[model samples]
Target: MSVVLLALSASLLFLPGLVIGLAAGLRGWLLAAGAPVLTYGMTGVLGPLAPALGLRWSPWVLLGGTALFALALAVIRGRLAEPERVWTRSKHLVVAGSVTLAAGVGVGLLFFASKGFSAIPQFWDAIFHGNAVRFIADSGDSAPSGLNVIAQPAAQNYFYPNGYHLLVATVHQFGAGTVVQALNAMNALLIGVFALSMTALLRTLRVRAAIVAVAAVLCCAFTGFPYDLLTWGPLYPYATGVALLPAALALVVRALDAPRPALVAVTALALVGLTAIHPSVSIAAAVFGLGLLAQRWLTARRVPPGELLTLALLAAGALALGIAHVLGTLSAAGGPAYDWAVQRGVPEALGRLVFFTRSFDEPQWWLILPFVIGVLAFRRLLPLLWLLVASLGFGLLSVGAAAYEGPWVALLTAPWWNDEWRLAALYLLAVVPVTALGLVTVLDLVRRPLPRRIGLVAAALSVLLFGYLSNGLYHQRNGNRLAITFGGGPTVTELEQQAMNHLAGLVRPGEIVFNDAQDGSPWMWALTGVRPAFGHALAGTEGDGLGKERPLLRERFHAYDTDPEVRAAAKALGVRFVFIGQGFVTGSQKRAPGLVELDKVRSLRVVYQNPDAKIYQLTEPDGQRPADQPGKTPPGGPVVVSSSPVKPKPTSSTPS
Candidate 1:
């Protein structure tokens, strides 16, 4: 099954991507103008279908799919004309190409960063929360976690978007799960391609813009100015969004600025592509579309009725998708339910302003100066400024940094973490615009010698600082050491060999392992061949906003805080085996009276004990198995997993 999933993942990504590319040729106009919308809509459609396409392929599948897609594209070549390249003066050509190459490498570096560059673990959430494996194990097949604005919230309920998973699953063919090296290579490649696309777009801009473009690319690669500010591992969805957003924006510029069916089609397709990257990026594209239209209107003596219609329809389509996703979640089991804090009072809104509170939070050190200059230089950049303004307003309004406190507000505006050291994702809200501003600002200051270089230097320093942090995390996880021992030793995922070996002794085919501040490590590396009974869960699904399930999950957690209830529940569910982890007081048995620690489980045999884990067996053998166990292999067919793990009942702590 894992093998098949890998093959299918490949087909889904490159194969369909080719079809989408070809679609650009025939429905050239539709594809161009609707790129974001189509991608967004298709995600909803394909997401649910991904699991049912039980067929997984191999590298052979990749080869065939690649060939087939290439053939289809070639066949459509006659139907598609080359987009008119912006004419460049002879003096600027060489410089432009050089700058373009620089940009590509710079962006590639950023992409490399995503592949576990920082001290932060790559695929942190998926591994710890166990969402990726959980859903796959639970549903028997991976399904879409995100269906866009139109998917019933119920439909997206079980899934949360994770870009790496989609790619890994395709080649995995057998749900081989995520591979750090493979994902790193893949993202590096994606960054390269995405950068190339941007370079092409920049070629059309002033040559001066090209040189500055390298800096912009560098900002993305090296600076905390925005995109580089994540600590929660790699942000697959957000980075993909940033990568694709530029392409979509370029198409829009071409479509609107060039004013031809070809360009219009290009813009449409870009819009659809925007939709595919992530709903937020799509929404941002729509905003870009509006900006284009507004600029057109302002420049024109009169506003064209058609442009208005186009914007209206484009927004409406995006809106429709949003509605569908929400509706779907409402109906699905484990759907995200965010209805608890609708009219969140003024006090709560003020709390969300802190940016550096969670796992990924860092002082916006390099971001500080450029942002000041950007504000000074482009007071007129209303859209970008609005992002800042909104973030500030949201922070001012939140009572504290509670999740539900400002999800609706964040939904209206992008969520900003005031203190993100450990929890959450590296969203593009700050990165994209900040990169744009830094690039633009650095471009203006290129000829200027001293203080001018300060921004770039600060930017570089910022990258090094954050990169050190993020990269350190990645290295710690992917490091080659067998085991470094304690705090000074094999950190985070860089678990010592001895600890892992110790776990292997105690863990059987299907057992629950609860460990440490970070929970997903065991599943990603330790339980690769077997199913885990229980692991960690994520508290941050607020990206869905005002979700009901979040509240339920919270309630369940509170109720189960006592070891007695959690243990009884685990036992009832046939989780007789337990692996207690380090860095956390994970023992549900801790809350129960007269309950012994797994380490001291005299009644139940101690199977394995390490610095990182303590594996234990239940005192009663009957408690180990259940009529219907989660990870157990029954006499029937093999288990098929879905992509969307049931969104943990958000508020209830209730097991799904």
Candidate 2:
């Protein structure tokens, strides 16, 4: 019942995508409907900084901003003439989009078929720990003695952002509890809009172009191609934000085609959304814009101020939101610690940035043939191609290489890289027109009694390339399945699940739990309704390792996990025990030298022990928790507030 209600409510977010799709037929509303979703998704990236902006939970603020945004776009859309969306007869587009969408879903399924989706029940880690964890931190209720953070001893402090959680949370604002359905429904709607946008954008090329691009993007939308699948960690805001990004880009394409204020405004909204969803999104937007502006200046000096201003404003909104979150954490009386994405050591920082390269998945290898053809035959496609170029160049720069920390990919695909893949999604959309342009010309020629050999060769090449990419992914899924036993015996996955379930069984209905698995690895927290020890995406820390170098850094991590100190930190705001998993965490490099050597393992009795994990009841419960532990706050006062506040709704869709 809760899920049903939430799913229904999530429709609020989903409707925009569908409406935007349908509105592709009604040019005036296309941009207006699409803009906010992008803005919302990007904003989702802000982490603990949102509240300072005076905008986080203020629906009216969003409503007003949206209204203003809509008005701005309406004025512009009204003046522009609609494109010729007579719907072209090109079957290429149909096959293309179908293939692409299929590729994405297929890739996802392929992975599932490979590993079987952790039959151990990932539960809400994909969402709750991803997003709600941030809410706890941003709300300044973070403390270590409460949930996952306090329990999981000696590990990396990932504190991954909860993109899935945010997605679900945001949906809950409108929907309530069943956010998963909401997320899927919303993505489906976006796919529809994505299709419509392609059709409209290439009215010159028609339905065929639309179908090809939409299908291709859809295939790549949630999943990567067959050959190269992604390794996921924690919930990524950028990935879920990608769900909103396609339409947002479609709006941008719309803006370029018609140059209406509405489309630009919509584009601006998308820019804002991208900004909010992930640092990569924000950085990509900024870099991509610079590239576009440069191209425009060199070739066409007559760019409009409205277009530029809209982009700037959207960035500002994202910045404001992000900054607001930072300020909140920095100012908290017993504020959270800092985790280092930045460094006192540039070389080390650069080292962390190395992995961002994993994000580089170029458009289909065959994109080259289509691109050349499109460039030669369709002049208008130049602008679209350039946009693709800019997005790619910038996305590469943005995914600029970062090492993976925790379960999430911190490099180019920060947080939720798994579920969303926003950067890749947008880029794919831009490249489709180039592809369509090429195919149309080819088909026109192939129709003639041209050499049968040429057509056969082209067809064979296309199939081989597609199959090459597809087959690899099919097999990759097979590789994800691995079996490990705990304590040389118990199933690692099962034991962890049992430990979590055990913890959950002990909690009262409204209690909260916390864990110290950093932020990204929500496995420990997701299954049991607990707050993560670290803030979202490890935001709000001042130094490396959960930012403990910041004064009393230890205290903040506790709070981020919804320390018992905070009224609503845990399910009952009371964590009865901490389950440290040998399988779940490998410990951090930065820990004190003898940390792991200590009898910490010998000290705690195992509630459940296996070769893989040992669930332990704390030698000391929350009230009697040791202050010396990493997340334990100094003994200035109680570890908890007198009366815990109500836990946030289960249905909420935060970025996770």
Candidate 3:
């Protein structure tokens, strides 16, 4: 039942955008692929606007706003005409079959890889993202302008993109499932969106139907994308932006090809959505757009003045935004200078780029054959070739940053925080269509010597053979990564989560649980509706306004009976309980200073205990139980503090 709701909730992301796209005169695949782009655009706009308009942020707002916008567009365009017959029955079937095949691969990969709908990713960023969704749901404020309040309640005018959070929060509010379930659903949805959008772009480029179909499936074959991003940082928002990018580029192509005002307007809106989701991916889309424009200028005998003007304006606008972003003028929370040390030598990095492998992952050597075939057989497709080269070149420079830290590399890579994973994902996006073309080229060569029906059978067998050789879209390796990311470690375990659920029932409303953030305590609010004093691992220590109080509690909370400051801080924050988990997020046995030896703290009493976790309620100065939590105890009798703390065995593996 939860899984069904999750699927339904994710499908809701397309409704508003579909309505708007139909009103804007978009047709066929353009309407189908472009809807999610517009959905995100609405999220980006309405997330911040809802608060200012004195309206609560909800899916209803998005739906109502979309209706209004679509109505306005229809009014401006004069009238809604009858839908055009854009494709024949056969072509429609081909498109549907291709998109479904690709979406099935993507959704299947995510479903099994993630273990289950309720499992939470244990990566560092997941801590913040999970809590952020809960924060938005609880506070009724989805604005990026104030989202940092999750970490620091006193934060003012901070900015981080909230479009991803808004969508997940919408899912949670609609009763899809828990916050973790909604997160997994959103991830699956983004993967499907990526496949659909990439297919639309291939069709827009006039690729043959056969190639388009193969390319859609190929989009999920690369390990560097949609999968790696899911494991490494679990970079959900960045993934969402990349998923929308192909459609945004397709819109750009459509607008430039015909130069209509409505097309240009819709293209601009899509870009806005892309930017709000992830600025770095927006930069990538801009680069691809510029490359396309350059190709047009060099190839066309005569370019229309309007098209040329649009190209110039786009370039200028991109430049202006880039400048503002680099100067830290775009938001109150300035862009971070992410400096990841080089993980490979130049030779190895270049080899990985050729195989579409990010970092030390297994290389897909099979991709090279088709890539070479496509380049050699279809040399006339210069734009595709150019994009392929550009993506590879950028990926090489990014992955080999330590070997080549020139000013140009710094300028080009800064927007992505100099991260190679992001650059590699972009390269994977380019690889899909080219690789599909190469596969089709091979099929053509084989088909020329055979009868029509036999040739079709051979082609089908060949595709199946390719999939078999690719290990069903590299499922085993990706599934293992997902398992490790979502499974038990020091960050969380089944027993620990069970204890968290138990703790939820013991606490009253409006009380905070004092806990070690590194022990996955940050997930408490999202999973159990029990607020933790520290919302993130680095929250109190990293200028999140908790200041001396958090540090004092971290070091001396177990000393509450003897330390006035610790007791005072606990009282001030309304902390009624202390939770101790099995181990640290890094899988270390070292406990937080204040959380250790809590069984010896006379001013605290064990309210709950399990093999992997323990919860203690703050007691009165005279060692009496607190008045608020009356009669909450273990199964048989009154609670008793153990003489010694229980130590559970810790897992060795850490989150990636």
Choose the strongest candidate by TM-score: 3
Per-model root-mean-square deviation over C-alphas: 10.7, 11.2, 4.1
Q: How close is every model to the real structure, measured as TM-score?
A: 0.58, 0.57, 0.89
Residue-wise C-alpha lDDT for candidate 1, range 84-114, written one tens digit per residue:
4444565245434534553355334433444
> Alpha carbon lDDT of residue 383, candidate 2?
52
Question: Residue-wise lDDT of candidate 2 within 573-601, one digit each (tens)?
Answer: 35433444443222221222212322343
Q: How high a TM-score does candidate 1 get? A: 0.58
Q: In model 3, which regions exceed 4 Å deviation?
A: 78-88, 301-304, 308-329, 332-336, 359-361, 378-380, 401-411, 539-541, 544-546, 588-590, 620-622, 625-656
Q: Rank the candidates by lDDT, best first.
A: 3, 2, 1
Runs of candidate 2 exceeding 4 Å displacement:
1-13, 17-85, 89-164, 170-235, 241-246, 253-264, 294-380, 395-445, 450-492, 507-522, 531-576, 585-612, 619-656
Candidate 2, RMSD to the unseen true structure: 11.2
Give the Cα lDDT of each candidate.
Answer: 0.39, 0.39, 0.72
Which TM-score value belongs to model 2? 0.57
lDDT of 1 at 558: 25
Q: Write the per-residue lDDT of candidate 3 for residues 173-221, one digit (tens) a residue.
A: 8776889888887787766788789877876776677777777777766
Query: Over the full model, what C-alpha lDDT does candidate 2 score relative to the true structure?
Result: 0.39
